[model samples]
Target: MSEWFYQESQTESFLEREFVFANFLEAFAFMTKVAILSEKNDHHPDWRNVWNKVYIKLSTHEANNTVTDKDRNLAEEIDRIL
Candidate 1:
């Protein structure tokens, strides 16, 4: 299986991750927490959820879709939440 974070598909301009939980409720709860954190930081991730899984893509739009330190830091924070 792939890791929590990886270079998205054949691209390096974005960092991507997938988190799996037991059920939809757990997944939504995690998304809620991340949403709050994203709002506070003003560095939201491109994310989606389906069933028990959450997929996140992080990149700086201002930097031409490059992965920046903000993305790395946010990834770290998300790891902590897990």
Candidate 2:
């Protein structure tokens, strides 16, 4: 497993990963999966979706910093859904 979704950068407080689906249904399904997992973990992602694509950014709001274990874990979970 990778330690990160991407390399941590000083200019940004979070790490982002983009995913594309074949249709809106697939995108929305992935969003719903992320939402459920976020609720369960009490960690939410900053996300946006349009048509068949979704962009996800993970961060620990309380830490106000780059990627952490929580973010990496969530990113992996999201990847599984994709």
Best model per TM-score: 1
Q: Rate the local accuracy (lDDT) of all candidates.
A: 0.84, 0.80
Clashes of 2: 0
- For 45-71, candidate 1 gives per-residue lDDT tens digits of 999999999999998888777888888
Q: Give per-residue lDDT, candidate 2, residue 80.
A: 76
Clashing residue pairs, backbone N/CA/C < 3 A, model 2: none
Candidate 1 local accuracy as lDDT? Answer: 0.84
Per residue, candidate 2 scores C-alpha lDDT tens digits across 31-82 of 9989999998899988899999898888887786667889878777876765
Worst 10 residues of 1 by lDDT: 1-10
Model 2 alpha-carbon drift over 4 Å, by segment: 1-11
Candidate 2 accuracy as lDDT: 0.80
